[model samples]
Target: MRNAWSRAMVRGAWLLASILGSSAGFCEQMNLREFGQPDGLGNLALNALQQDAQGFLWAGTENGLYRHDGQRIERVATQELRRVAALASGGGHLWILSDTGTWWWHDGRLERVLPRTAKLPQDVPMAIAARGDEAWFVTVGGLQHVVVDRQTDSWSSSPVMTAEQLARHPEMGRLASVMLARDGALWAGCGDAICRWHRGELKRWDARSGVARQQWHALLEASDGSVWARSTQATLQLSAGAEGFVDRTAPSDRGDPMHRYPLVEDAAHRILTASQLGVLRWQGQQWQSFGKRQGLPGDGRVHALLSDREGGLWLGLRGTGLLQWRGYGRWESWTDADGLPSSVVWTMQRDGEGRGALHVGTGRGLAAFDAAQGVFRQVPLPHAGDLFGLVPDGQGGLWAATDVATFHHVRDGRGLPGPITTPGGTEDGFLWALASKDGALWVITAGKLHRWPEAGRGPVQAVPGPPGNAQEHFYDACETPDGTLWLAGARGLARRRAGQWLSSLAVEDGVTYVACGEDGTVVAASEAGQAWRVRTPGAAKPSLESLDAPVLKGRMIVSLLIDSRGWLWLGTDAGLVVHDGTHWKLLDRSQGLAWNDTSGHALYEDGDRSMWIGTSRGLSRLIDPSQVFATALPRPVLMSATR
Candidate 1:
């Protein structure tokens, strides 16, 4: 008993370490929607982006101004205002700045403002900032300001500071970018310094004031009213009432100079920026990058970014057009379009060599996951058949089973010649499941159980199945830690204990799947979605207890898994369901799965504790199960009792 207790403690410690260690570097799943010429944008080089109050996205490209109404993009005809450089929206208007001139769109009217005849800077507009009816433009010549007369439907422009005023305040001249804070303060990026203009007062922070000595290129105000300044070398932020700007640049930014792009804050108050590496989100006092592995399409260099009203981020790439990111979540999927061999995944298992690669068996053939590239590469199989079962051989090799035979020692995309022939020459039958226990392989096929030794010295031996009068069509099998073999099929649930078949639990519908937990707990389910749990599995007198899983009723449960945390996961026809001891949760298409119908024996848990579910349309992964199940516990309530 003491030894058992010690083993339990060791298992608990390992489970805890796995959960904590995996989460430290876990990447949240991202859903991305790409928009390009196929969607009506004339040019893919998006230079500026903005979303209006009505939820319409305005994109400024190198050729013309385009508007996306959540469905399609159409160019807003501008007579000669081409080569759009920047865009801003304020006061029920979207302001467009081009090399030709500046224009504003309001209620379907495009009016050109601050033309060359207006005596504005001839150096070209680099950035624009707007608030209410007023707009500010930063040009190499200086800063320009424009105000609209709503009553008269007109506009006027003037230099923010005259030549004499510039001579007095040289630190605010040669402006590059500008931004208007929530508190009505105007911030601008000067040549080598950042300046703020608030209520007729000017404040400047330069190298002398501890600011990084680089060309300040962009400025932004976060939701919390903190001003962020982006320079050629670093990114700095200045809080309200702070003495000076604090450098918040990531360590990786020191080597890459492309991190000087614009910064935008999401609705959650987290700051995000685009770079050559990918989208970087500022959280926990550091930057977390999301690139192709996180589902960002294209080269990851975003020319412009906008956080929309729906909490979605719009990324404007250089030549790849527009992409809408739904932000990080627990679910992500990959389909055949993402380089998978087939969408119909049958089973998946981790590489026994401990390389962290997942080998997937699909209807077409076998494929291996490429974690670095975020895609799947097909692993050529010697035999041309749909693989239904895949398991690690516990000797740095893999075992795959098809309808006719089972191949062992599959490595480096090659399978050995020797195949354990199916028992009874059942060429017409299908191999349902395979399990490895005590260095031996257990196979279930056509209602019969067979045990094949690892040495491969003799022919396969048939084992006694559970006692049942009905035709037994076995579908799944699992071995408990106590050397008991549990089988599920048309005959219901059965177990082989101490070399003898035990009594089987007969359900109204035949059981199709079974899973064994480390604590000697056994769970079995039927196609009709009825589930039963055995707390004292492998015991002399084991009894089945019905689980109160109403959500699973009427659903086709294709796969079941008892994860290290003791949570029950069910891959069903509708979605992926989980019972975290008490409450039940479902994740489907709305929650980021590619498809609703899951494949049989396609549920897997990797060394990192992340759950992988295979569906008819694609493969889906749940990054961190603990985050989904870490719901707040119910609080105790006091009740008044009547005497």
Candidate 2:
């Protein structure tokens, strides 16, 4: 039954891609799959990937090393060897280099390669190249080589290139990529040039030889003894020249070179390069690109690429996690199944029939998040480029604000036929804010404010609020309990009462967000992370009271919300700041947040008071604010002692 359901979904995705004019058979020809924490990957921030001789793929991540067979992934249990950066396999063993040190796996047992007392120039090894019993290690100090001594159950390393020899090369102490040539010589790519270390000497060619002196990202030696070198701008072929290995442009590389890792030549001799734009290949004399449209996960750059022996291509994307594409147009993407649609989430809200359901505004569109299922059901909005904010429409539905215009979705899962455009609104100005108060709908454009009296009962009219000269600088606005609307502008906060415009508070740094506390206290957040309490007067002018908090002094506040507990939740560029009338506390990525950079107007609290945080990376649902600062239960005070 599951197989049948998956087949049906695949068909639907293929049909949708076809209608969108994507690559022919994009969904049918390729299947993309991603793997991450849910699949037992130690971390999402991947650094390197290597397929061992045993057909198992090894991944180096920030947390530790993970090994994946054809079926499952398992974390390699090493003694204090976490935070791996690179991996290599050779001589029936796996070489691992991490911040901790270097280790090699042999015969189902892992052993430290470096002696405990050996003094190395640099502690961290950046790149490794291995073949047979010899492996090359590149570090900030210089290039070194190690020879495995199986008979002695030990390994020995020596300097392959002296610092003096490397001084002439580009990015001398920063050798990033290395590979072995067919002639038993070592080739390495540095920041400035590609060098060959042969016969105890170093040789290099630069822009003078038609190959520009840029960072050489990767190097690969083909079966036919042709070496392929990749730089940010070009890919070159180094064949056997009369004097030595001469460099020439690859006939297949016609576009800008992907600044990714090394080029891989598959079993079919097809040269491929994984890049931010997706995977590219040189086939039939031309380069072909495959991206998200071609069904290769999110459009993040592919950090790690592997050409499996079974005719499959594996990719480790920075944001999208692991993706696999088997031959015959099959691809699959693996990620946090319960995470946001895109890491760059813009806004989020809680909606439901009394029970909270997550609604996320993302770069793609609107998504309905299922907390129990840990999945997001995407609901694409027509013509909505980037959703910015979502607000409850008093009737359980929501008002969605986008880059183009404001859209209204009615209760009972129905949407209006067209956008709710404000009359006399600037066509060039993007929609910034949307709110409904006292049976009136208010929309803020680049420079002007539009209001629909009686919540669309009357024709839209341009309401005077922002200054005529700088209409585009308004950031946010909200309504107080007394039907008074507050606007945050470049100057500061302004209030409108009974159709009369009044400047309430002005600050030099500008105000970005405005929220009304339950006790009728109007809190205005400044772009520089300062908050001011406004005293809403009945008939007199409003007064401003600065609410000083050292914790939020320098941060840029993106959104401000007053929860039921009367705590002012300020979403800022640094993190989340909570002001409980007097004291201020911070919650950030270190405190269980998926991302620290919060988006403007992206904070929402459900009836249950679970805070929903929208950030530049993804959406975070915090069940209890107190849990952020988890404290160990008070140890039973057996006896009170005075020190």
Candidate 3:
């Protein structure tokens, strides 16, 4: 606080708003500069969202195919199965299988045509399943097939298998269902028998061996991906390797009447057995019946059920509001009482962690959840959470720079361990927060760019920058993992690399911060939010906004931070956003961000996936995630980035 250099830092922070007063002010007048989805891909009905191994969301909607990377949704416009029926993925790319052929979303690019032909099986994929290197899908033609050779990646009109092979297994001729078991084997639930195809061979097992008088109804493979099936008279569990079946519904295992439509398996030990009379959960040893006796949708016949991200089960009663199980013997109804979209939830998607949210986007804007408690709430921002720059802190935390402020949080629901403070207070601000090579926290406050040894084990320290004229004046500062500092203010942008303050980026190869990878490039953005390196400042990279004034009017880019995943998060005046290597994604209210636009003021990471986004209004954290929903599938709604 006694440093003369720190005094200069406080006086130089006003240069940004003053510069914005020109172009940004003009756009603000016209109200043309909005931050979110101002144009394209209007509220696309995102029915299916899955995350591939690479962490990108492959969305299959009622309309077309989109690739969402948590910030922006990319339309596979060319020939990506419009009105896409079923979506399944494996080996890194998304398989957009329609009624005719497959469109491969592979290698960060879309191949409009994988292969489709009328001469081959009818392509309307009912349900697609996959194992390690292989995948199997059932077409409306009643046939189960695999992705035989993606390396060679060739196919033909003729059957992938021989006619003799098909003749030998007439039971598998009409494929009804399929599932990829936990052990990486593909299970084909045909009308007669369920065959296992994996490791270059196909094997068959029929239901007659278990349910003598019944046929297979449904199949569910859980997180472990173990395969389980239910028939009219029995519930069978597939052997780990899928060599045979274990029928649990014998007279000993409870010879209950078999369920007709829904058969959900929990890992492999339990099965949700639904019958016209009632519903029961069959663990390895017992059948726990739940119905009017247990407050499960007053009706004895439970038709449909949806579980939220919070482990609360929801039952879709034939004639009642959606029901929720609060705790032991406690039921909360979401009829007209709460903000439920409808009493009749034909289908629901429990997302964000099964702890919150049940997206039922029917006729309204989009109704589901508003995360309440927990340090890391998965609620939507009022409108924007688009991502921009990220610096993954390796310890399960990330640093995000939004259009608003810096943001950092763990993806899981766990809250921060303690109070987050920079080396100093808010006076050295506007853009004065960053991390150091040894995980030190550097911030500009009062009269100096303060440096706090991030762990607190060391003494609180201060790093002084250029002085300014007024007490209200201050500068912006960001640190890198390598001890470099990037600071900006009324004067200009400056960085410290080799123990010296370089007035420009060129001294450090035009990098804002010390980066450990090829992605360490600093962007000097101003003038309609146009960006280039500070060195160039006018070369084109990608447009954060196409319109100039709309952003100035309402939504301004408030913060920017980076995550370990190499993506950029932007906290904008409108909301929050993220930028993957390729696209711009707006992460605001609709996608479960905080209600306030000031959510990310000072961001930091914990070296893991944990991110802490500090807003002027409140503090928010995204804890380390427990469950990762799949975007490589055609299911319903958001992922790392919500729709």
Candidate 4:
């Protein structure tokens, strides 16, 4: 309650008193601080670094790569002074590779290319491994073999191969990069692929061609010959079944804006980082990037987020607030301080002409905001109401749905008004979910579904179902990509597609809830722990599964949200389950999703990609697809116990 200096004075007095007095002899002082970038690394962003076999630590910096030998700092430059794509260790030297294949470095002198006829592509150079006199370097451009003739102190090229070259090599793609495994098996990230070279034999692995995996990034061969490969997007293990790149933190992530920090996958060291941008391996040397790539939110737990046709971000959050990621790692956030009603916004919908309207859902009522009105004005409705959902009908007249017993707020002469007393069926339970598909308003009632066709429909026709299995009531309803109108019920599942009541799934599948995504992925949760995901048949799926998250094996997942990355965010009773579908990781009291949900409750993804979990302990959030916590948890209001 005091000013900064006053607070400082109080702290100083406490410290002085603790040091001078306290018969208990415990002299302790608390120091609070706002987190910022690492100070020693200074202002320049660090990307990555590698420790060579010797005692030197090579650091990747924004301006240039630096080599430190405990005493002197050596500045590394590209062969042509271009942007250094990355630096790797090979043949007892810190090899500096640029985005361009034109390899160059300073062997205790000015930086210069080692020996390459062309420039590499723009992807950062990942790994460089040396075996005997033969050295291998991987770049976005392609893979190259550099032979260091120690006898002559010179370098020679074996062959320059690109992904396309290897693809056309009459075999698989060229090796992206090569590394010596702990078991002596040579693994190669060939082309957009992976392969093993053993006993003068090259065994190529490509998940796409039924080989193994394509987006191969790095390969790790355990001491027992078990192979682990990290894909371009997910992670995969050989003996454990191949998968994509993975997130193995407290909660695995997929680049959400709600998180304050990001969860970047570090494939090089096989660690998940919470830095700024998502880099691969980090042996404590890399840039400070904050987003889903590392371990935080990409934007903020965006209560509402609008993406422009140009892919720019417009966010709205309750706590840490809003932001817009321009590109790469550049983002901008808007706040009430910057002209807005409040940050507790809810749903956002894209209107005509590529414009987005953000519906700010506060404790009071609903409001709207866009580029035109930087601030929000309460939607003029009949009475005070709490907004539940907002759907933009592509036409000028948008539909705002609320949950105050009376739903529907139509736009009249004023901005938004009127709770159109649409007949909510002759039931008593609340309308838990809403959806509009195939030109019809699909509303889920307590035990049945009501469809109001816009073609002169008065009362919504209630589709009758087998008596309310009182024990089981519908929670949510959806029209799947397969044109099946499905309902998430308690005892069993129900569906009505074409004038036929198809409740066969009830007898077939043991499901309690159903969540179908536009991505043809149908996930249903059972009363038991197993969440059956009936994925549409696809090719090369098993090979792309990542067994990376070592945590989410047995969590009884309840609610499922198919996020922007196409991964599923499973809110469980005991914890939060994150999986690209195949491989899963758990997030609980230890990993952040600390809700006392021994019995699961409501789960939602706010307008922003932030996942909101409503449990017994109130609400928790997962900003970074990996982190689940209560960022904007409501503080309890306690009246005086007595006079």
Clashes of each: 0, 20, 132, 63
Residue-level error in angstroms, candidate 2, position 507? 2.3
For 531-636, candidate 4 gives per-residue lDDT tens digits of 5555331222211112334454455544555665567765554666767655666655433332435222244444455554433332234444533221423321
Candidate 2, residues 1-643: lDDT per residue as tens digits?
1111111000000001111122221111234456877888758767778877666788877777888875677888656668787788887778888777777888877877765543332222237789888787776556668898889978888877666666665354666577888888887776577777788777776666655766676788888777777765577776656223344334433435433544788766777775556667765344556665455666546667777654457777665666665322221211123333554566655544334454666766666643333345566566445666565665566666665555556332235554575554436344355454566667766667777664535577777654443353566777777877777777777778777776557778777678886666788876666788876544467778889898997787777888877888888778789877767888775344546677666677655566766665555555556543445343212101100
* Residue lDDT tens for model 1, 479-550: 888888788766577777666777777766777778888777789887667888885776667777888888
Better of 1 and 4 by lDDT: 1
TM-score of 1: 0.63
lDDT order, best first, reads 1, 2, 4, 3
Candidate 3 scores a C-alpha RMSD against the true structure in Å of: 17.2
Model 4 CA lDDT for position 386? 40
TM-score of each: 0.63, 0.46, 0.37, 0.39
lDDT of 3 at 632: 39
Listed per candidate, the RMSD to the true structure in angstroms reads: 10.5, 20.1, 17.2, 21.7
For model 4 the local lDDT of residue 193 reads: 66
Specify the poorest-scoring 10-residue window by lDDT in model 2.
6-15
Top model number, lDDT: 1
User: Against the unseen true structure, what C-alpha lDDT does each candidate score?
Assistant: 0.68, 0.62, 0.41, 0.42
What order do you get sorting by TM-score, best first? 1, 2, 4, 3
